[model samples]
Structures are given as structure tokens and as C-alpha cells.
Target: MTKALLKYTGEVEWTPPAIYKSSCKIDVLYFPFDQQSCNMRFGSWTYNGFQVDLKHMNQKPGSNIVPVGINLSEFYLSVEWDIIRVPAIRNEEYYPCCKEPFSDIVFNLTMRRKTLFYTVNLIIPCVGITFLTVLVYYLPADSGEKVSLCSSILVSLTVFFLLLAEIIPPTSLAVPLLGKYILFTMIIVSLSICVTVGVLNIHFRGPSTHTMGPCMRKIFLHIMPKILFMRRPPYNPGDILYREDTDGDGYIDGDYSIDSCGDIKDGSKDCLNYDCSNFKSGLHDDEHRGRASVADADNVIPRQLTPEILSAFEGVRFIAQHIKDADKDNEIVEDWKYVSMVLDRFFLCVFTAACVLGTCGIIFQAPSLYDNTAPIDIQMTRITQYGISSPPTVAPRL
Candidate 1:
């Protein structure tokens, strides 16, 4: 009893201090943004409503019609939870063993979770790591680090999931919003690894190993490069064309041209076609002209050395042809590499869009994330009227 009335007033007041320990079922579909309502029932179990009726002490002045909920004047605030409201209602139930009804007061304590801790520690880091998947395509394929980065990001996400598992309940009823987002990100990272492998394969292709068809060349080289805004350096023919005077003679060592009949043309007026079938005939003609000039001048025949000189010229032409073929092969290999670069740029754009849309779409699905209302205030009274008091004496303390 908080206060005692006069001896003859026939009135009394009671106040009891007690502690309660209870558990409430939790719904974690929204996780960090979830709100929970826990109901606490208070009533006397031994007495029925007819003998010991329960009444709400905090009511409006001069009226027993409106019932005000519990007081919060001494309620301590929590850092992680915000008290949304505390509404109390009176209920009466009849049991088979009792004729009268049993009345009880149910206080519903509704609270909203504060998201600052989760946003900084879990959500932001997950989002940042998920976005890194798109940048894997931006990295150069030749660097050889794309797969390593993807693996590391996958591991990090798994760690975050474990941490989250420890924090939330392990019920398999429904996956949380954050869990869905993490799983989606892991799938994206795994897909990125597959894409990186393909890009590397395309980058390392050679002309001898793989032949690029016209359709592929048109799409990867002509069309896709334009869409991706990729441009190759200007072509220079002089860079690939080899020119060297190996013998240090007045003329270039391998300065020969191939005609339509596959004949090597050495710069001379008479020897227009240097085919092996007509080599002896052309050499004999040159020797005959030389002998005639020598006979006409000093009766001396020129030495027959034309066959050896022609064989030496053929060797030089063969080396020059090999060099030219190598240059063409290098150009083809460069085209394949450029095609790989275009694909990388294309995937970069695609993964970036997917990451952004997936993050926004999954996170905003929570209903309470958009709530901006303030916590409701419950009025408190210094004194409470539980039952009738004789002589109309008021309680000094409650």
C-alpha cells in the first residue's frame, strides 16, 4: 500500500513492485528495418471478474469511459530500438470451469529497430563489394588478376553472411531482404568469373590457331567498337614493310616484285620474268650478249657465272617473302585482341546496370523503411484509481 487512509474511512491503496521475464516471437522478413509488437498481459488468475474486476487506473477526469495506457515518465530510452507506441486494452474471457468471466489488461509494446548500426556495418559494405564485380570487366584482361579479385569478393560476401546468420534467427521460414541481396550479388560475381575466362580466351587467340570469320569481324571490329566508343591507333604500312641492304651493294638486296604469273621481277629491262623454267635461257641470252661485246672489242669471252648469281638472288627473295607473311599474321592477331577489348567494355556497362538496379530493387521492398512518423506519447498520471474507496479519500502516492 502506497498510502494509508483514516482508520474509519474504510479505504486502502496498494502498490506492488515486481519484475517480469518473457520471450516474444520475432518476424525477421524485414530484418534491420523490422518492427515488433510484444503483448504483456496483467491480471489476477485466482479471482473472476465478478469478485475481483480489473480496471484501467489512468482515465480521463470525471469519466470512467476512456482508458489511457501505461505511463512512460520514467521509461529509459534504448539505443537500438525506438518505442513506437504502448496501447493497452481490457479483455474478458469465460472458462469452462468458471461461471464468471476473467478480465486482464493487455499492453502492446510496439518498437521499431534503429537502422544506423546495420546500415554502416553490414549493408554499405555489402553494396560496395557487390559493385566491385562490375569493375572486374574494366580491368585489363592481360593483367591476370580478374579471377583473383572475384574470388576475394566472393569470400568477403560469405563472411558477411556468416556474421548476419549469427545476428538474426536461424528460422527457414523466409529469407531476409539483406540475405536476398547478398545471394544475388554472389551469383553476379560467379557469372563475372565466367565472363572473365571467356574474355581471356578471346584475348589470347592467334591467327594460326583460330580463324575469324567475316561475320565475327564485322560485329566485334566494326559494329561493337563503334557502340563502345573504342578506337584503334592509326595504321602505318611502313612499320611492317621490311627494307634492308644486307650485301651493302648499290641496289637493295631483296628488291624484287611478284607479277601475275608468280614470277619474280628483278629490276632489269631484259629479265622481265625470273621463273626457274626460263632461268637458263635468260642467263644464256645475257652471256651471249656479253661474249659478242667482248669478241667485238678484244676477242675475249666473258666468264659463265650467271647461274650462281641467279641462285643467290632467289635465296634473298625467299627471305623477304617470309618477312612479309609474318607481318600480315601479326596484324590478324592484333585484330583478335581488339575484339576482346570491345567485349570487356560491353560487359562493364551491363554488370554496372545490373548491380545498381538489383541493389535498389531488393532493398526498397521493406515496408517500414519508408515510415517517417514519430513515436507516440502515452500520458501518465501521478495517482491511479483501481476501485471504489469509502469516504472518497484520495491516494497520496501511486
Candidate 2:
């Protein structure tokens, strides 16, 4: 009111500095990329609309001019939030207790959270941990580190979840996108631990401990190897042939000396009592005549072979049978190990794909992640003395 009467129009202006604390409802569905709108209403407490009127200070004296919501020429910038828009409107309302209308100015403060801090501190580290979870399948089972690695990663994700719990408000309405991603990653890690245990069990299995079944052998050894593009050397029983000269005979005891009839020679009674006539039943016409002649030669030969030679022959057969059984067992054990390897390769592919897709799907669910458009300009329709009227729309500022 200082010197206001001196002016021809008698208008006075006053500027005051004030601080306000506002409580805004936070929607953390998109978290760091989220936008929030908080309204600040200003009005005189005692005077009614008829006695005291409220108007946007930036409104001009033209019908087509748009009202600037707030003066930002001297506004200080914030590090964590960007002011998207500040739209103000003048409202009039009639209360039940009063005959006159109440007037107020409402300023809608729209802000977007800046994502660089969350990206650097939270997001990138989470992505790294997700990739590390995939690496658990790559480590060899014999290295004895897979379970330990999974445990460490699970603990790390738990720590991250705890940190996020502290940052986010304790509301049960909805879970934040970042929290969902962390939980998903933790679950994948936990499953990896179970998979590692299974793989280790398969890798160390022995024929004596667990016999390989037909279905398992077909899936892991026959089918999965081809699907995963794995290659292995074909098993050769002869390659693992073991020879022992138990009596300095310089011959592999595993090799049995056989006659033309496929029976052991050197006076084994089982061979001496051989039923040569049985060969005729399955032989062709010419093969039967050849076997008939061989049977006559077999009948003339060898009841004179000594008891000591027979005992040596039996001992050699026993050693040979033992060696053959050992080789078969060894092959089975190796097959189990190979099957374990195939499983590791299979899971490596699966976890890598799941981790990549799940991470991208969850992270990109926020609309603002890919949106590059400029901030929207909110136009306020003027509420005039007669009625509400549509105002001229302005293009958004870039």
C-alpha cells in the first residue's frame, strides 16, 4: 500500500519470500524414471471470493495470451529432479457455510526424477550381477567353486534388496520395477545353486553308486550332445585293453585261445564237452558242412591236456573276465561325467537366454525408458465470471 494512491490506477504490488513444505503422494512404479505432480493451493483465509479475488500473476491483458504458471527466471535447479511443468489455475468454489464464493490459486508442480544417480549406483551393478549369475554354469564342476559363487551372488542380491527396501517407501500397494528385477535375479541365482548341486552329483556319479538308465543315457548322451553341438571321442573297449602276464606267459590273459567253433581250447572241460552238433541248427548249408568237418577235428584233439594247464587256463579266464568288467565299469563312469558336462552346456545356454531376456523385459517396462519426447505443456481452460472457456493451446517447449 506504499505510495499506491499516487498512481492513476491505484494498483499496489508487494513481493515476499516464504518457504513451504509440501507432502506429495509418491508413485514409485517406475522409480527413478517416474514423474510426480504436486499441487500447492494459495488463497486468503478470511475473505470470500466477492471481497478478495485471486488471479495468476503472469496472466496478460489479451484473450489469446497463455498464463505462465510460475516465474522461473530466478529458480534454482535441482540435482535429483527436473521440473517438467508448473501449471497454475484460478478456482472459485461456494461453501455450505458461506453465501459468497471462495477463490484460490492452485499451482500444479510436475517433476521428473533424474535417472543418472540410480543408473550408476543401482542399475549397472544389478546388470553385472545378473551376468555373473549366468557365469555360474560356465565354471567347471570339478573346480568346486560353483556353489560358493552362487551363495555369494545370492547374498549380494539380498543386500541389494535390503538397500532398495530402505530407499522405497514402506507401502504394500505395489512393488517397484527395480525391486522386481532384483527379486527375479535372486530367484535365478537360487535356482542356479540347485542346478549346480545337481550337476556336481551327476559329474561324480559312478556305475557302482548309480546305474545309468536307458532313458537318461538317451537324453543326456545321445540327444543333448547333438542339440548342443558337442563332440566327444567314441568309446573303444580295445583302447583301454589291459594285459597281465600272470605266469610270465607273455600273453594278455584277457585273450582266450579259441578253436574254430568259438570255444576255449587247452583242456577246459566246458570246451572238451562242447556240443558241436548245436552249431548245425543255425548254420547255412555250406557253413553247416564246414562246421561238420571242424567238429570231427575237435573230437580227435585234446582230453590229454594236463590238470595244471587246465587250472592255468581257468585262472587266465578269471583274470580276463575281471579286466573286461573293470573296463566296462570305467566306460560307464566316463559316460556319466560326459552326461554331466552336457547338462552344464545345456543350462549355460538356458540361463544366459533367460537372464538376458528377463533383464531387458523388466527394465524396459517403464515407458520413460525409451520415450524421448519433450515435456508436455499443460494448458489451463480459463474459468471466467460467466462460465469456463477453452483457451488457446501452446506448443510444448523443447
Per TM-score, the best of the predicted structures is 2
Clashing pairs in 2: none
Model 1 scores a C-alpha lDDT of 0.71
> Which model scores highest in lDDT?
2
Specify the poorest-scoring 10-residue window by lDDT in model 1.
293-302
* Position 389, candidate 2: lDDT: 52
lDDT of 2 by residue, 1-398 (tens): 22322335543333435567889888888876777789888888799987777655465554322345765543445667777777677778888999999998787878887899899999999889989988888898889999999999999999989999998788887889899999999989989999999999999999789998899989988898999999989976553323334564342332333442333432222222233323323233434567434444334224423566456556655665666678789999899889989999999999999999998899889877776745433233244445545544532210
Q: What is the TM-score of each candidate against the true structure?
A: 0.71, 0.72
Question: RMSD in angstroms, all models?
Answer: 10.0, 10.0
Error of 1 at 98 (Å): 6.5
Please report the TM-score between candidate 2 and the true structure: 0.72
Q: Model 1: number of clashes?
A: 0
Model 1 TM-score is 0.71
